[model samples]
Target: MNIAVLIKSVVATDESVTVSGGEIEDTEAKRVINPYDEYGLEEALRWKESFGGTVTVIGAGADRAAEALRTALAMGADEALLIRVDERSVDEHATAKLIASAISQRRFEVAWAGHMSVDNGAGQVAIRVAELLGWPHAGAVVACELTDDGKLLVTRDAEGDSEDWELTLPAMLTAQQGLNEPRYPALAGIMKAKRKPLTELTPELLGVDLAGEEASPRTERLGCETPPARPAGRKLAGTAKEQAAELLGLLRGEAQALKGRG
Candidate 1:
């Protein structure tokens, strides 16, 4: 089983987000492997351990993104490939194109990625890559097994429910949160990862045309603003009857306001 896992480097969730000139100033932000992508990496590692094959971690981003690939390496992936792209030119479609092009250069039995990237929250890249590769794809997979016949049986999250699917080899799957607990990089593994092969590539190297007018992003960002600050909670005072009355009053007020707007 030659497995490929997709990973992303993202701004740390706890770090403060600073926006400058319609873009997030993330250059100085603490970076880490995207939380959801970690599950995909772990699943790939598990599959490799069971079937005995090399697991290659693939990523597309600026130079700093290599650190995330290294982290995946430390977590047990055999190798890492980074597709360097201009930060401004990287949208979901462009990213998928670059990743698909890079993967096309190698032989892989299966591919895995997070259901969505935390930074952009655009859950379309992995499936789009599958489309570009003309391979079947399953999203939000929580469990996967290789059958005796070499087909992959996967259980995936379907909103509040679950769905099971059987796909042939060479398919792609996006991992959900319940897939598996991600393993931390051990000290020895961390040291070993430094010695592991980490290759970097560009769109030119991959024979991808990123310069044409058709390469422009289909979607445009108009602007970005921080969410409004949450209002302070109001504490009710007095007996249950008084609180109930207060709640009803508040509801009535909201209803009247909505009616006025209508």
Candidate 2:
């Protein structure tokens, strides 16, 4: 079996967020693989381990995105592909199209990606890829098990509920959180990754214009401003009933303030 995992480079979670010029200012930020995508990559590697197959890690973004792909290789991907794009403003459809165009000719039995990205969280790229490939897809998958006949048993977390699904070969899947504990790259794996085959391709070569993003969402940001700091909590050193009454009065006062009557 040949499996492909979609990986994305993202700013570190602990980084202080700042918006400028209608985009996040991350020029100096550290980059790494999306944590959720790491889970998907781990799942793909596990399948490769059990089934004895090749795992290809694919990423679409700036050249810096190869960092994420290298992380995948370190964890045990057979190969890596980097779709280098220079621009920063890319929509979900264009991103999906670029990736699909890259893998149109490659024969892969399964394709998997994270359910969403930490930065965008659009959750549309995997669906669009499945649509482009004319294959069925399941999103929010938390677990996966392969049968002897190559059938995939997948599980998804649905808020307070969980559901299981069976999918045949040649399917696209978006992995959700809780899929599996992602394995850390050991020294041997890291050394092996240095010798792994990695290929870089440009979007233009794929006959896709990743620059033009056509779709726009209903909401647009006029400007980004930091939220006002919350006021310090008030001290109510009194009886329990008196403290309760004070809290009630505060809530009512906030409501009246919104109504221009406080």
Which candidate achieves the best lDDT against the true structure? 1
lDDT tens digits, residue span 1-262, model 2: 8998999999889888777776667878888898888888888888888878899999987767987888889998999998887535556777788788877869999999999889878888888988898887888998788888978898887776889999887889988888889898889989999999888888778777543443332234466666778988778868999998877777668645334444
TM-score of 1: 0.90
Give, for candidate 2, the lowest lDDT window spanning 10 residues.
210-219
Q: Candidate 1 lDDT, tens digit per residue, 1-262?
A: 8999989999899999877677777788899998889999898888888889999999987777899999999999999999988766767778888899989999999999999988889899899899999999999999999999999999999999999999998999999998999999999999999999999999889877776554446677787777778888889999999998887777669545334442
Off by over 4 Å in 2: 211-223, 237-245, 255-262
* TM-score of model 2 vs. true structure: 0.87
RMSD, every candidate, angstroms: 2.5, 3.1
lDDT of each: 0.88, 0.82
Off by over 4 Å in 1: 233-257, 260-262
